[model samples]
Each structure stands twice: as structure tokens, then as C-alpha cells.
Target: MLTVYNLKMPHAVYGGENAMDNITAILKNHQAKRVALFTDGGILASGLFTLPEAAVKAAEAEYYVLSDIPPEPSYTAVQQIVDQFKENGADMIIAVGGGSVLDAAKLASVLVTDEYGVKELLDTPGRAKKCVPTILIPTTAGTGAEVTPNAIVAVPEKELKIGIVNENMIADYVILDARMVKNLPRPIAAATGVDALAHAIECYTSKKANPFSDTFALEALDLILNHILPACDDPEAMEAKNRMQIAAFYAGIAITASGTTAVHALSYPLGGKYHIAHGVSNAILLAPVMRFNAPVCEDRLAKAYDRCCHEAENRCQSDSEKAEWVIGKIEEIVRHLNIPTSLKEFGVPKEDLDGLVEAGMLVQRLLVNNMREVTPEDARNLYLEIL
Candidate 1:
């Protein structure tokens, strides 16, 4: 834990039932006249945009929809969306989708200037600042893009995803309405739920973990581990879905205060190269990376087990036993979710192992946060386990 640490969050957050209705008041408060709505085709097609659209109309705001953003978008792709936002001349942005859409909108809010854009920020993130305020409405419970200062984009040249970190990019407002995620397809719900699971555990065990992060990270673990299965498996389980939404946001807060470790670092290559969903890639690597770090992080993992596992029959007395149980529980969750546990499902050949190792190693910003230092050999072996 660091002697000095700080926590950052959105200016305001509204959640629970009818949270989407807050959008109208938020628009009025921002005095946003011309609004730019950012999302992808799938969200628009799913009619998930209806609530926010109605809210925007109720505010009597003139809104233009920018729904061309792709999944796991490249920086150039984000630049294109920024250019479209610039051309439309919207004074505010409302992002309504998963991580990719939210991330693209965050980039657009800051990339309005000719001086610097998403590509420039990739190399010098501090060069950009927020020009337009944003309201982020997440359709998935994972990614925590709504509350984080980081925007992840793929760098196609390197075939790896990189995070653009700037405090200015945090959402000005966040609305977490379970209605937005109520009907989410099972596969998406499963992948994203596990992604939040990875975030909570990884942040708790991070070398940078401190009092501020542990507070949220532990609670997030409890909520996610207990609620994720029902949330994903049953369509009518609104209570579980709502808790998962809050858990994802709390996990996102954990990321902002502390950080993610090797799980995220190694998973980036899979998303960047294979065009795999970010949540899916993270789900694939979550257990393996946690197991590898268990030797050094067992004490923290034991604490997590104590917090998250409340079932009387499953209690373990020793730290090692608790750690093993925690890891095993993670594996069980992944298994039950049916998220691919092996890279072979993605057709990631063994021949690509060397390249995967090289790319995963480049993400030192996150790798350094691991309590157990990850070397080139360590990364190679971790990737091989999945491959």
C-alpha cells in the first residue's frame, strides 16, 4: 500500500430504478442544448437507446446520434468519431452502451481541439483536456468506463490495446439503470460480469492497493461473486442484475484508485490481435493470472474470501486454504459462465505464443502493479496455460 494515494470519481452518480430518468435533469443542469449521443449499432438496434432518447427529448435538447463506434475500436476509429462530433458541433455528449462506446465518447469529449486528438493522446495523454461534459449510461455492468479516467483503444500497428489515462476524461455524470442491462444476452452478461469479478480481485491484490481501494474492491467482490451467476442465468433476476451493476461501478472505482495487474496486461493482446471482446479476453485470463499471483497475494486473497464467501459450509480456517478456495471459486465461476477458458477456442495458435508474450510484456503500466513481479518467462508461461 502506498503512503500517499488519491481517489477520483465522476462529479455525480445516480443509480437504481428509474435512474435513466435522471438524464433529463442532468441535461438541464448542464444547460446542454445540442447533445451528441454516442453508441454502437447493436445498442441502437436493441432499442436500448429509447429511454435515454426519450429523456433527451424531454429536456428539449436537440440530439444527434453517433452510433458508428466499433467494438474494441482502434485509436484512429476513435479519432473518426471525434471528428464527427466536432463536425456536429454538439456541446455535450451522452454515451449509452458498453465500454467501447463509453470510451469513444470520453475520447470525443476531450478531442474537440485541433491541437491534439486520440492518436496524439496515445503518446502524450496529458496533452488533452475535457472540452465538453459527458453523461455516461452503461448498458453493461462491467468496464466501469463511466467512472474511470482511462480510455482503452486498440493500436492496430502493434496489435495491442493501450489505455489512455487522463483525469480529465472521467465522466461528468453516470447513470446506472438496471433496466439498461435487464435483457442483455446471456453471453454478454456472463463475460462482462466476470470482467467485473477480475477487476475486484486484481485491484485488491495490486501492489498499489490501499485503504481507499480496498474499501470498494472488497465490497465489489462480495456483490459480484454472490450475484453474478443468478444475474446472468435468470432473465427475471432484477435484484441480482442491479447489484451486479453497482458492483461493476465499484470495481471501476477500484481501478481508478489502485489499478489492475497481469490479468489485464496479458489480456490486452488477445483483444487487440484477435478482435475478441475486452470482457471475454479478461474473463479468459482472470483465473490463470490470479493463480499465478496466489503465492505472493494469498493473504489478500484470503481477506477477499472472508468478505465474499459468507456461506457457512464453505469457510476455510487457514490463509492458504482460503486463498485456494478463492481461486477455485473463480475457476468455478468461469466454468459455469461457459466463458472460454482456453485460447484454443479463439483459434489462437501455439505459434503465436512468442508474439503474445512480447505484446503482453509491453503493458508494463499494468504489469508493474502486480504484487508478484511478472517477467518475460512468467508472461510466456501464463499465455501458454491458456493457449
Candidate 2:
């Protein structure tokens, strides 16, 4: 039996031109005197800080900025951010970059008002009593961390990338200004865009998928498949980039309701052990896992293709064929974007394949969402095929 679904997202969403102007209003509304800003070094160097910094200054709010966020943030790193947020006596937070920074901010905000450690809170979902109000501004168009209740954090000691899912992690406000995504490089654009697409695809095929998740996922898939290439070709094209950003945000909402499946579950170890960027890892595994799941999900994939494919690709004869066509298109996109298609590119020694499989097996929470159950042997073969 299917359970009724509840969608999760930020309280208010601001986008397009003049979105940054609302920051000052939120600060005042909350009577927030001091604000914490979190971002990655790449965004800090991109000169996108001017607007938000000015907004905070104009509101007469003291701002504390932390821009040293790493590619995939770790549990210890977020704990440090939590300490700093509390130490500065920040009453609110402004997360001002991509997924990593937003996730760091999400974890930090929840930890600031509670005594729970990162592991405890993530491991036990509803323990946090409260969290500081937060406003998220996406400098990059992927990860959809702006409105998600889940945050991905790396645990280096265990060589695993884990999700911290909690309702309190949701941001109070989300800003999606295209100006911030203008300088994204071609590779990052391609990888992150595919990452967003994977979120929609995986959720659409997840066991927990319902009418609401399918609606959001299909819409997100449409937006992403149509505009991803245009956005990559011209980062300065605000229209294309805006569409991709919206696609990512929609996919975020979809996954929050239905959750992601084997693709995300299998990719975590690649991220944690090899330090392959999370998006790239997802890209590598997406096609293979989709192909694996196709036998059981052909009708669903056919429906996805029918809704998302262009006129040129819509003439496929059968559902099985259409499913293969969808898989092929993803491969073509990855090739066009110059993403590495194999684990060997990351130089994983063949002998260590077992370790990767072991790590992937541990992500049963996500694996259970797969339309077809993922067995240990199936996991091994999937990695071997990719290798």
C-alpha cells in the first residue's frame, strides 16, 4: 500500500533579479543582530559576496563569514562551523554558495542550539529541539541544498558519505539569483546538472515514489534535460542557467518526498574514499544502475521519456527501447560534458574493489528505496561493470 506523501521545502523562496534585496527584510523580521555566513573558497574568490555583504551591512547586522568549506564537507568540519556560529553569538545564518556550504550551514544551524554532536543528530533524526533561522543563496545551480531537509556529510574515519536527514535542517528562506551561477566552469556545470537529473530519475523510480513525487520529478526532469546543455554552452545565458537552477530545486523537492535509490547509495563510497566529487560519482553510476533497474521499471522509464524527450527522440517503438534510449542519452550527455565514465579514472586499485562494495552495502537506507532490491552480489557486479 502507498503512504500519503508530504513535501518539504523552505518557507519562502526568492529568485531572479532583486532577490538579494529580501535578505535585509528577513534579518529585521527576526530581530537578528548578528548573522553567520558560510561559503566555499571558490565562491569567495568569484566576487559574488558583494551583494549579500552589503545587504547585511545595510541592515546594521554584524556578519561572521566562514569561506573555507571543502569540496565535500566532513562531520568534524561541520562541528567546527557549529562552534564558530555559537562562539560569534550569531542569531541567524546566511548560507551563500553551493551544496557543501549549504549543508555545512544546515548542520551547523541545528547544532548551534542543541548539545547533540553531528553523528548523534544525523543517526537519530528528530532529536534536535530547534535550529537558528537560515537563508540559503545558491551560487551554483546543483545539489538543491537550498530547500532540502537532508545534508550530505563525509565521515573520513569510516570512509563513507552519509546523509543527515532532519526537519529542523530546512532553511527559512531560499534565494536563486542567476547572477551567482554566471561564472560556473563548463565541467562543474555539466557534472552538477547531471547530479540534479539523477536526483529526479532516482526518485521517480524509487519504491517510495507516489503521485506527488512523480509530478515534481517529471517536471524537474523536463527542465533539466532541456536546458542543461544550453547552460553549459553559455554560462552567461541567464535564461538557460535559471531553468537549470529551477530544475535542481524541483528535483530537490522530489527527492525529499520519495528519496533517492541505488545510484546515490552506490556513489557515496566513491565520494568518501576516492574524493571524487559527489556529482561526478553519481554521473558515473547513473547509467549503469538505471540500466540495471530498467527491466523492472521499463513502463516508468518509458513514461519519463515520453514526457521529457524531444520530438526527435519520441519516435521509439517500445517501452524497453525507449528505456534504452533514455540511458543512451545520459551517456551522450556525460560524454559531451567530458566527465570520466569509469572508476579507473580515479585510479582505484582493482584489489580494493571489495572495500568499495562493502562500503556501498552499508547504505541500506538508500538501497532499500530501489525499485528492485539490490543484493550484495548485484552491488559487486555493478562496480565491476563500471570498472
Candidate 3:
């Protein structure tokens, strides 16, 4: 019984070394005279923007950098960019940060033409649509916002991390520059690497996954399993960091097709309500959610186990043997990355558990993608177990 699904993505993408080198040519082809570059402070400090700067200047275009986007971006922040984009008449947006920055830029592009602001986009009946062309450049190997058709935004008024999911949210161009990520801090690397791992695992076991997505998901999972730890220990290893970047891209492509599951669905509340980083919030919940969903996806988890622990599998004869092997490998990866194992370690109070579950339930957009239906009880239990 195959189910119906839909997938969308970036129109053109440039990856590998000097990929940022192609930005000028992309601008020329698009005839963009003004471009808005969106990034966060971390990326601005890293100075990877120099490559894009030269390209924008070479194109003789008016460029402005908005580096105010935070890890958990709010609609207030998003609309400010939208207002600037419309008032300044900048039609081409080049997002140059991590997932939140790219998502903020994507929303700003969509809302600039409308009479409304951020609140209306979320509350209004119809607002998010393909309006302007955007080019995404990711500095983190975590959220694959570069290629996906959905943007995760914070709605502070509602105290929720809402998603603007639409085909129009896809970037017109995606530029992957490995040099940009070489300076990422160790903690950032581990958190984002876990994020990419979560993305691949969630999408592979998602209810929406199809054959096309399976290809990307398995490859991404394999790469993260093989490379993330090394990338953390040796950021100098161009080979390992490059693989992690590609893994993030592949994971992004996988989610674009198959969608993210309960881990992502449950993570939004922490980001929106508590200002937790998206990757870290997702990271803490990923293992627990997987442990919960494993039964529903035992065969899928077994296959993922096959990817990482082939030698161990030869001695296993039961599903329990394979499940333990799979869980152990995932745990080892988390240990390698040094991501916090518990939500409470990050200041999440036990009292907020109910609200988090409520928020998760309202996040119907992502919950729909879960392989198992996520009830309020299920969401609560997942959080409590992690606690």
C-alpha cells in the first residue's frame, strides 16, 4: 500500500570547493541588481562572507547584510527583513547563515509583497507563496535549509516554532562552500552533525519516505555515521568536513522529499518558547524519539543498523539483537559528538512538559510526517522519558 507524496527543492545548486565562486554568474543570469544577504553574527565573525562579498561587488550590485537573525528566529525578526526587502526593492536574497537565517530569509522574501507582516503570514489564510528568488549558503552542516521547501520560523506571540511549508520556500540557488564551515566551533559541529543525523534517520523512517528519498537518506546516514565524529575531532580534515557538508545536503534533500519526523515535530516548542537552538533541541530529543518510534520502525532501524554494524549483525539472530546494536551505534555517535543526553541539562523545566506536548500537537505540519501517529500522550511520554 504505497502512499502519495510530494517533493520540491532548489532550482540550481553549486557544491564543493569554490562553489561560492559561482554567485556572480548566478546573479548575472538572474539580472539581480540588488541582493540582500542574510546571516547571523557567528557567520559574520567567521568572515566566510568575503567570498560572496567579492562576487556581489563584482556584479556591481547593491548589497546589504542583515546579521541579526538568531538561532531561534522570531517573526518579529523575519518581518523586519521583509520590510527592508520590499522598501529597498531587493528582489534577490542570498541567505548566508545556518538554518534559521536561511528560513528567515525565505519568509522575508515571501512576505515583502503582501500588505501584512509576520503575524498575518502565520494567522492569515493565505500568504506564503513564491515571490522572489533566493540563494542559500549554509555555514553549518546541520539543518539542510539550503535545499528544502520549508522554513522554520518562531512565532513569539503564540510561543511556537512554526513552519512555513510551501514549494515557494525552496531556494532558487544553493551554494555549498566547505571552506565556510571549517571554522565552526566544536560544539556547533557536534550539535549540527547530530541534527543532520536526526534529519537522515527521521526522514528515512518517516511515513512519507519514498524510493527517491530512501536513496538520499541511506547515503546521508552512512556519511554521518562514517564522518561526523572525525569531523569533530579533526576539523582540519578537509575530507571529513567535506563529507559532513555533503551529508547535511543529502539529508536536506531527503527531508525535502520524505519530510522530518517526530523529533523535529517535538523540537519546535523548545526553540520558540525557550530560545533554545534548533539543532540542540532536536539533538536532545532525537535519541528518545527514536527509542519510542523504533518499534513502529523496527525493520527500518535494522537496515540503518546494517549500514553501521554489519559485523555485529552476523552474530544476531533476533530483532532484539539488531535493535540493541542499532541503538548502541547511535549512542556512540552522540557520545562522539558530545551532545547533551538529556533535555533537563539544557534548562527545560519539568513543569513545561504539558505545554511542550500541547505545542507539539499544534505542530500538525511536521507531525503529519511521522511514521507513527503522534498523540498528545505520545508526545508527553517522549518528553518525560527524555527528562
Per-candidate TM-score against the hidden true structure: 0.99, 0.97, 0.94
Q: Output the TM-score of candidate 2.
A: 0.97
Name the Cα RMSD for model 3.
2.0
- Clash statistics: count for each candidate: 0, 0, 0
Candidate 3, 121-196: lDDT as tens digits: 6765256776778989888997998888777778887778887776778888998898878878999888888899
Ranking by lDDT: 1, 2, 3
Candidate number with the higher TM-score (2 or 3): 2
Candidate 2 clash pair list: none
lDDT of each: 0.92, 0.87, 0.82
lDDT of 3 at 218: 92
* lDDT per residue as tens, model 1, 1-387: 877999988989998789999999988988889999999999988988999999999999999999999888999999999998999888889999999999999999988889888888989999888899999999998888899999999998999999999999999999999999999999999998898888999999999899999999999999998999999999999999999999999999999999999999999999899988888899889888988999999999989988888888956999999999988898899899988888887888899999999999999999999999999999999998888
Q: Name the 10 consecutive residues with the lowest summed lDDT in model 1.
A: 306-315
For residue 298, model 1's alpha carbon misses the true position, in angstroms, by: 0.6
Which ranges in model 1 have alpha carbons more than 4 Å from their true place?
none
Q: Which pairs clash in model 1?
A: none
* Residue 114 accuracy (lDDT) in model 2: 52
Question: Between the candidate structures 2 and 3, which one is better when assessed by lDDT?
Answer: 2
Quick one: ranking by TM-score, best first?
1, 2, 3
